[model samples]
Target: MILTGDIGKVKTLLALFSQEKEAKEVARREFYNKEYASLQEIISVFLKKNESPLKEEPIFIVCFGIAGPNINGNCQIYEPDKLDWQFTIRELRELLTANYVEVLNDMPALGYAIPKLAESDLVSFNPNVSAEKGNRAVSLATGTGLGELLLYRDRSGDFLPSPSEGGHANFAPRDNWGLEFLTHLYSQFSPPISWEKVISWSGLQSIYGYLKDRKGVKETDAVKNRLNREIPHEVILDMANQNDELCQQSLKCFASLYGAGVGDLALRTLAVNGVYIGGGMVQDILKKEITKHLFIEAFMNAFKDKEGFDKTKNFSKRNAAIPVKAFINQEMVLMGALQRARIMANLD
Candidate 1:
């Protein structure tokens, strides 16, 4: 069993290896984090649902790709502000009786999954910019929370993946509107607000609320009722698809800021090999929102934004070499967890 956990939901994928030893899916289920008391319960449900398979086949390994708190320490999912559930490794080992059990931060799991990704799994908005052999790469995912992973080329020419909590890095403002947004966040949430505040599902909603309440962008009562009744991001995307002006405005803001934030990461990491976008939510917008081009433009502008480089063609040329690609697979995180699990069990 391979599981991936985030702030909003958890996904479990039951996989078996093919004749070539590649992991193939057997079953899958998604659980809302709020509905379950802990990760143990979620795993128990998956196990119970597949009683027949385990009875004959047996689960040899169990791995979890989770965000938040350290896997080696408390075995918890994120902090209290996020999933807030905790389970020790010992308990899981006992529950599964698997030969190997591994749990890690989702970023590293994503890192493990990158090199294995095929051409079909990757897409870029700018067709002219293709991935190249560079010294570094970075993966940034925006879901219920923001996630980042860094891949550095070693002396042997292989890219090594490493986990980073860079999403928790401080939010930087680029303009007057951004400065005002920062001030708004400071007023409500505690200090040391991170980029996750401006780049995730809740982040987009925060942007929408800011526009409606402070900037006075119009919002109708019908839209308000739908937002209250349904998922905010889903409703926001639905309204944007229907050409709701305020929803479109908020989406533009979210996409632009998300692009800008990624630009900062590209510069900071010098990720010339590739800048991979990995979350399903971000990809959903890239597929659904009409203003995806705005995201590309904002990304390029911020990526090339450098002091004394406004007139330098060399700066733009060097920055332009950074390839930005989005990973569209919804089960990428699960695939990643399976990859690690296979390695742990010596099945790959």
Candidate 2:
């Protein structure tokens, strides 16, 4: 069994897999944690619900890919984003009675899925460029928060992934608008603006706030109501799709900020293999037609990865040469956990 999802959402996703003769899913379920007293409760219900047909195959492992960093089998989550209670690996082992239990940071979990990603699973930002093998990086922006990490191949050619606290690193502004946004955030939240402040869910909302409150951009009352009641970024994207100027500008700002951050990751990690953009929010971003162009162009312009003294031509060439893609499949983390579980159980 494997579980993966944002902890802040109080959601549980479980997948049962068999790797004996073939690697495949035997069963799967997704449920809100709020519906049950604990994960143990829903997992018991899930097992009973799917018991009969697959009773012949018994589960031997359970792995979790957590949104926060994991150290010594315990998740070091942000205090404010605590789960109802942290589930210990030992407790999970007892509940499932599995032979092995594993925990992984979400960013690394996302990285582990890169090798298995098919072209169909991606929407390329810089198409027609082949990625050269080296290190790779993943930058994820979810409703929960922002995460970044690195993946490098071992001697055996399997990826060895690591967690990162890079999202909390200071935000680097790109232009006047970026500086203005930084000042706006500083005025509100005070000092040390991080990339998480400009590129994640709250980041998206921050952009909208900058436009509506500071730039004096207009927003309809309906949009305002929707923003309060519905998911903020989703509402913004929907409004942008409907040609709302304020919403459109917010999306554009988000794309550019995201580009700058991804550019930083690619440069810092020297991720010649490629840079992957993933998270729960990707679907919303891709729904608007212009978002891809906005993101791609911004990423290229921000791709100050490397340049020779020749400057202009070299800068353009360097920017255009890097490979970037946004993955829309929401199952990568779960699949990654499954992959890790398989590795733990010696199935691969």
Candidate 3:
């Protein structure tokens, strides 16, 4: 069995696999925060719904990927205010009566699944660049919050994933506009705003709010009503697709900030092999028209700016040439957790 927790998004995904050497997913389900408050509750409901699989096959091995740091097969969720929600491998083993349970940070799971991804599972933004064999790679995801990971080649020429909390690093403003944005965020939120404050779902709302209040942009009555009724990011995206001027500007700002964040991740990790943008928001944005214009432009601009460096050295240019792609596989996190389970069972 494989379970993945996106604590930032307040959701958990569960998948059950057959016992063959080549495990196949036979059942899957998703649980949201509105329905379950704890991992134990999620497990109870999952087992009840998939009782047939349990009775027929009887799961023995389980792997879980969770948001936040994992220490000795245990993890705690800390974003959107800290919670008592915590999980441990030993406790999960007892609850599920499984022989083995392994817990890992979710970002590393995404990293582990990268090399295994099929070509069809990706949408490339940089088609001209090729991933250099055995070079390092980085993955950055922006959703409920930001998540990052690094993948390095081992002696056996296989890439191994290492988890990171780089997303929590301080936000660095790159230009006058960024400085103003940071100042605006400081006035609205507390000081020392991190990248998550500017690159997430809430970040989109923040941008819209800034434009409306500080920039004197007008919001349509329809957009205002929908914002109160639905998720702010969704409403903004929908309006932007419909060519609402204020929402369109807001989305451009959001995409530029997202691109800047990606650049920072690439530079910090020196990801020569590639950089991957994941999470559900990227998928949704790609489904619209914003991707073709602002997102890639802002990404390349921020990616290729090495302040005070000689243009002849081409440091920024070379780094900009690193392949960047959007991870389109919804099952990536599950696949990664399954791979970890296979490793624990000595099946890999």
Candidate 4:
């Protein structure tokens, strides 16, 4: 049996895998923690639930796709509103008692799984923009935090995934509202604000705060109660789906900023093949009417909005025509981790 994990800020995903008599099988579970609990605690709770199966099957390898940079087999995962935590591959191997352990940045893991995705796993945002063959691709995930990665075909005609800290890049405001939003964020946080501050779960909450404080929007009792009880990001989405005016506007703003970030990534990477939008927040929004209209409009328009660069109109046009997709497979990161583990063990 193989153990795979995708550790992030809001949720830690775990999958137990085994080869069945006729096919490969996997069982998945999620651990939600506000503080992004220690890895030992997470694994302990997971093992408690799957004790019987674990006792019967000897785990072969463990692979973890964590939300942060993996430097020299060491990772320092950054959590929103919490201190960064460190994890090393050597320590992980000893703790899990596994023969091998692999740690990778979460976004690159999603990139690794892109080629393996089925047609049903994707929701095309721009069907008219056919993906160019042999071109590069980018994956941007917005969740507890934002993650970005680039994928290009190598000399051997195989896709190679590279992780990036692009999410930490400075946020560029395109309009008056964006400028005001940046000012509001600056008031709340320190200098050098990044896209992660505006496009993540906490980012949504920050947007909501700005809307409420600066725009003087009113939140209904339902929204207030939900905000007090559940995750603010979830609450905002639910309220938006329920047609709450303030929440709707907040979501629209978030969508636009998200689109802008995507456009920037597309331009930076020249990802002509596609730009994949993944993560829990995007998945939630995709289920709502907002994604069909407001989100796509903002995303497409931002990609083509090169008002100041009249000479680079063609570049904007090219970007506008780039294939943008929403990845619906929530297990993509885990699948990628598993695939990488197989590759590492020479089992694939």
Candidate 5:
């Protein structure tokens, strides 16, 4: 007998289901150049490649948006554009009876999961605020697209997940150099590339493409070669380390804007309590560009109303008594997902 699992019956999101090897080696080489592709196409490509011969056990699928905090398993069916506003359990039950549905904030899961991966305590901070207590953790991933998340811990030794559409937040440029970079970026993309657009992995291409277009170098070949040969994070850092003029300027634009964006989130959430920087790109920055004094300088550059903001800056300052640290928990998202799953299962 064939038994079908109710979509809502899923306890937790198992893991991101994209065909990894296929995505990197095959799908990406074949179909990833487009701006966006249908979900069906993505699923079809993924499923076609992973042909596992096994019994058709009743399986639960947990789904959530990149920015959604809640882990409702039914977001897939509602079809609404906004993730937070998507369908709830009641609606999902209308379609399937045997399935379970869960909703969770993606960022918190990532934040919580990092600690699990790293097997250590984590300090997570993201641009968006989750209502949970304790320090927050946030990250932005740019492999296939942008993913923004928040991580928090409560008194019960549980991670409270929160998610944000922060990657879509407005871009705030600092310094004349930043202004120039933004201007150049805007002139190229029709809708205009925001910080999220410029800072992500794909965004680096956007940056390189924009630079080439504005400079009128007629070197699409050279730019693509750079992307294929070097990751943006490495290229930016290498340029900075070498102190090349254009590379320095590009990195300066990136660092200043990035610091400001982080500061803004810090202010909004009063993350003076704690703030962390993670993501594939941040790893490169910390390894290459981060310094206490310079970090503080770039961060404070955005506080326009100097007096109170300045005072608060001191209070929230990263210092010896309360130092800022990396997430340390590398597999945070997976752990968080499992924790959420366990909670959903009501395990002891």
Candidate 6:
């Protein structure tokens, strides 16, 4: 199930899934998404043609990253819910007559890709990016959801992968200002705003909407309609670029939230070796200095929550808390799945 095939280089991954009648039928009838069926069908054909039958059980990893059928490098685990229990790799391969299956979360798939990339290679799984040095590495990706991955050489000298669901955790507002903002957000929203609520794409629009309403910012009819509907990060960015003060404020708030969140994550994990910003928002905001300022301020300010770790000088170093430096601009999850497939199948 771990398909490492290039998404950018190849859009139609028919080679991974079989196009046979049985596989196609299972994909179309059993799965909600037709792309899933197509993928399985293609892979089944490839495996059957090669005649590499699985032993007792086929070991596979279903990677949910990027677009459905593109080999784009700048993809992330945009939609992982597609691989829920209903979409089993076993059933997928069964349609194709394959024998084994394994399912892995997208974050770990990126971790799986680390060893395949050269030491100096600047690679990423797009929305979820990571960097590595020797056997130690770190990955962080956020889109519809948030996840973290840590890989290091254990005492036994084996590289192991770790996963985290940091997005679902509560938000750690930085200071009185952030607290006020959080209070405002909480008062408006239901209660106990999940980190994902503030960090996810919709989260960004929610912040923008709040700012727009508070400031009475005059937006275009289209913008207002979009705001009332689904406001994308790019639309907000465009407003900021147009010198819209309200948009600027919204962006600032986003940066602060992002910084505080990442800082808390670093402290919790001690990701000193390197930290990566892998999420649609991070990629968009990284291009501007204001975004960096807010994120840096809020993230470093988290140290104030504790002693020893809150030292001011720690924020000055660029390497310790690099942003987007090790972005996985590639379909890292897919690549990781491919590398893992190679390793597990002893193809390496």
Best candidate, TM-score-wise?
A: 2
Model 5, 166-226: lDDT tens digits are 7777666645655766787677666545567766655554554555566553443433466
The lDDT for every candidate, in the order shown, is 0.72, 0.75, 0.76, 0.79, 0.45, 0.52
Candidate 4, superposed: residue stretches over 4 Å from native: 8-23, 26-61, 75-87, 94-100, 134-141, 216-230, 290-292, 307-313, 346-348
Clashes of 2: 0
lDDT of 5 at 182: 75
- The alpha-carbon deviation from the true structure for residue 119 of candidate 6, after best TM-score superposition, in angstroms, is 8.7
Number of clashing pairs per prediction, in order: 1, 0, 0, 0, 34, 31
Tell me the tens digit of each residue's lDDT in model 1 across 1-348. 433333223533444432126566666667776677877787788779877756767777766777555546457664455457777878878887877777767677777778778989877756687667764555465666788878887687756677787888999988899999999888779998899888888888899999998999999887899998899988888788778888888877876777677777777777878788868776777675465655556656666654454455454566677777788876665667777776666665
lDDT score at residue 238, model 3, on the 0-100 scale: 81
RMSD for all candidates, in order, please: 3.8, 3.0, 3.1, 4.0, 9.6, 8.7
Q: Candidate 1 regions off by >4 Å?
A: 1-11, 18-20, 24-61, 78-84, 139-141, 154-157, 220-225, 289-291, 308-315, 345-348
Please report the TM-score between candidate 4 and the true structure: 0.80
Give one digit per residue, the lDDT tens place, for model 3 in 126-228. 7888876645555455566787778888887877898777777888888888888889999988877888777788888888998999899998999999988
Candidate 4 lDDT tens digits, 1-348: 788998876678898877333226556788875544577678877777888888888677888888777889888777657646777888787778888888888877888788788989988887888877655556465665677888888886767797777888899998999999999999989989988888888888898999998999997888888888798888888777777898888878887788877887887887888888877777887787754566667667766665445655567777777888888887888989887777666665
Task: List the candidates' TM-scores in order.
Answer: 0.81, 0.88, 0.86, 0.80, 0.56, 0.65
Better of 1 and 4 by lDDT: 4
Q: Please provide, for model 2 over 92-130, each residue's C-alpha lDDT reduced to its tens digit, 9 standing for 90 to 100.
A: 778777778777776777777877889899988778888
Tell me the TM-score of model 6: 0.65
- How far off is residue 129 in model 3, in Å? 1.1
lDDT of 4: 0.79
Clashes of 3: 0
- Candidate 2 at 59: error in angstroms? 1.7
